[model samples]
Target: MKKDIILAGVGGQGILTIAAILGQAAIKRGWHLKQAEVHGMSQRGGDVQSHLRLSDQPIWSDLIPFGGADMILSVEPMEALRYLPYLGKEGWIIANRTPFENIAVYPDLEKIYGEITRQPNHVLIDADTIAKDVKANRAMNIVVLGAAIKHIGFSVEEISDAIRDIFNRKGEKVVEDNLRALQAGIEAK
Candidate 1:
């Protein structure tokens, strides 16, 4: 099996955390994984994106060619649209409905969402709210990651374990909170 994913969001939104979790999981599954990341002023709310490729066999490159991605999992609505050019015909877009408006004049949210809905395959989630509801407001990124878990070629248990491994150093409470955030995303509408 293979998955070519583009993960997008602004800095400080846990975009890299999501990538780390997925990368760890990929390793556990004994899959070939390659990644390329672009960080834009992450400390100051700049754009951050990563290309993650996973397959049973060796992957020749880390970058995903345009129109070749299997999924675009974005933590920001606009960021999701930014990577549309990389999505394949049947690729799915699992994106949060929230917007991290760092620009002086952000586009109309409704219009941005309109474009996202126009896609044939998509799952738009209010991950921020879901994370808050789970009492893990800081884990919103994990929530988005959880929402896209179904399309990630890994089971919830598998990803949960990866979460545990990644957050083990932080403490059990942190781990459990993140797991709750993950479940919240999975149960999101």
Candidate 2:
């Protein structure tokens, strides 16, 4: 199996964490993984994105060419639109409904949502709200990841194990909270 995913969000949205979890999971499953990160003032709430390619076969490049991404998992809707050119015809866009509103003049959220929903395959979620509801407000990224679980080609249990492994250093509370956040995300879809 092969999956080319683009993870997008503003800085500090845990884009790297999501990539790490997916990378770890892919490694555990004996799959080949390639990732390339693009940072636009990532330390100042600017755009942060990564191209993550996973497959049972070896991947030759870390970059995903235009119109080649199988999925775009974004923590922000507007950021999701920024990578539309990388999405394949059947690619799915799993993104959060919340906007960071970092720009001086942010576009209308309804319009942003409209553009995202216009895609043939998409899952728009209020991941921040879901994360809050799960008592893990900081885990909104994971919530988006959870929402994309079905299309991720990994079982919930497998992903959960990866989460546990990744957050093990943080503490049990974090791991459990993220797990709950993940479940809430899965349920949101």
Candidate 3:
């Protein structure tokens, strides 16, 4: 099986962290992977995106063609919409509802959300709020990652384990908080 996913968010929002955790999980499962990332002006709150392709067989390229992704897992709502051309007809968009408001003239939230929710397959999550709820506000990206649990091929255990492994070096409290944040993401409405 092959899966193409687009990870989107602003700089410093931990979009790369999500990619790293997913990479670790895929590695643990012995999957072949290709990833290409664009970390444009992240320090200036510019757009950040990564194209991640994983397969049971070999993956020849890192880039995913337009309209080929299985899902777009995003930590920012606008960033998710920015990649609509890459999203497949049956693709799922799992995105955070909150706006980062980096630009001077951001679009209206209602219209943006209306367009996003109107997509046949979309799940908008307030990952920041959820992370705060779990007392792991810094893990908002992880919370967004958690929201993609069902959409991705990895088992919940696989994801949870990956999180533990990723955060283990950070110490116990960090591990526990991230775990809770992941759970909150999974259980998000």
Candidate 4:
């Protein structure tokens, strides 16, 4: 089977890092993976999107066509709506409820939340609050990633192992904190 995922958010939210971890995890599972990223004005809180494709066969392209993604993992609720058109009818969406004001005019939280939940396949999580509770608010992206892990069909241990391996070079504490943040996010929902 093929899995196509799109991740979107503003800059400094670690969108690229999440994509990297997912790609690495797919690699670890011996799946052919291709990832493409667009970082338009990302440094200034502009839109950032990464496309990831994983399959048992080789992928010829790194891009995902409109409405072709099986899943969309958004670091912010507004951003999730922004990319909603790209999600397929059976797609699953995991989005954080943190409102991002810098990116387009911010919408009413309650209205947006209601609309997002109305979608057939959507999962909303308070990743920002969870991150704050874990004292790692900057790891919001990782938190969303953790929440989406189950839908991606990978074992949490495998993803955690990939995370540990990726951040091991940084330091023990950093790895530990990220793992904890990931676990907290995964368990939150």
Residue 163 of model 3 has an lDDT of 84
- Residue pair clashes in candidate 3: none
Q: Which lDDT tens digits does candidate 3 get at residues 19-136?
A: 8888889999999888888744654678888999989899987899999999999999988999999999999999999899979999999898998999999999999889998899
C-alpha local distance difference test of each model: 0.91, 0.93, 0.89, 0.86
Per-model tally of clashing residue pairs = 0, 0, 0, 0
Most accurate candidate by TM-score:
2
Candidate 4 regions with alpha-carbon error over 4 angstroms = 40-43
**lDDT tens digits, residues 21-86, model 1?**
998899999998998876545557677789999899999988999999999999999999999999
Q: State the local distance difference test value for candidate 2.
A: 0.93
Residue lDDT tens for model 4, 34-74: 89877546567677788999998989977998999999899
RMSD of 2: 1.1
Task: Give the per-residue lDDT digits (tens) of candidate 2, residues 106-162.
Answer: 999999999999999999999999999889988999999999988978889889999
lDDT of 2 at 140: 94
Clashes by residue pair, model 1? none
